[model samples]
Target: MIEGRVWKYGDDVNTDVIFPGKYTYQPLEPAEMAEHAMENLDSSFAKEVKKGDVIVAGYNFGCGSSREQAATCLKAAGIAAVIAKSFSRIFFRNAINNGLPVIELEDGVDDMEKGDTVSIDFEAGTVTHKGNAYHFPALPKEVLAILNDGGLIPHVRKQLGRE
Candidate 1:
């Protein structure tokens, strides 16, 4: 179960804005790079976000670069989950690999507003907001196992059982 404050965004929020290229050579620390997260889309994004807030966006979200920093910055900023109409392939993988839940919703982004409260049940593939329920495609069992274990590396480590 994932529950948090919701933040809304539009379509095609690419990775460059999530983690600016200008800061790519700077550092890997979450805090160091977080201030620049979504800089292009919303200059005040970093300051406005609060811990445990979830980001809801329109189609083709995270549409550029293979940088995991985009996912990293969001996690660092304390975002709990990301629900979008569609996602870039690499970004989707990176998000799950880093243990950040990313859900793909079909439509109705315009119906939601920032600061709305949301709850997601990954196992059931259902999202609840203001007493309304929205359904999404269910992830495969294998993928769910990895997510439940808190990401690929950890899931692998558990399978290996190396302490």
Candidate 2:
């Protein structure tokens, strides 16, 4: 179960805005990457985002170059999960690989607004907000394991008993 305050956005939020391209090549750490998360779209996000906050967005939520930094920065910024109407194919996979819980809530997303409190039960595929429950397909067990282990690399390491 993941519960948090919603940080909402609209469609087609690309990588450049999520994490500015200016610092992409720099050898910044996770914390540094977080400092710039959503800097272009929402300048206050990095400074104000709290741990376990959820991002609710519209269709094509991550629609841009497959920069892994996009997902990495959001995770480092303490985004617990992202609920969107749809996602770009590459960004969807990248999010999973980064241990970010992303759900495709085709309906009821519009009912949510910024600063609204939401709760997600990944195993149940439900996003609860303001006494309303929105449903999406539950993620598979393998994917859940990866997220549980904090991402693909960690999950693989644990499976091989090398953690």
Clash count list over all predictions = 0, 0
- lDDT measured at residue 113 in model 2 versus the true structure, 0 to 100: 90
Model 1: lDDT to the true structure? 0.86
Model 2 / residue 42 / CA error / Å? 0.9
Cα lDDT listed for each candidate = 0.86, 0.90
Which candidate gets the maximum lDDT versus the true structure?
2
All candidates' TM-scores? 0.92, 0.94
Which lDDT tens digits does candidate 2 get at residues 35-70?
999999999999999999999999998888888889
Residue range 1-163, candidate 1, lDDT tens digits: 8788878898899999888888887757888677778888888789998888899999998998999889989988888889999999999988888888889996555677888888888778888888888999977778777877888899999999964
Off by over 4 Å in 2: none
Top candidate, metric TM-score: 2
Task: Evaluate model 1: give its TM-score.
Answer: 0.92
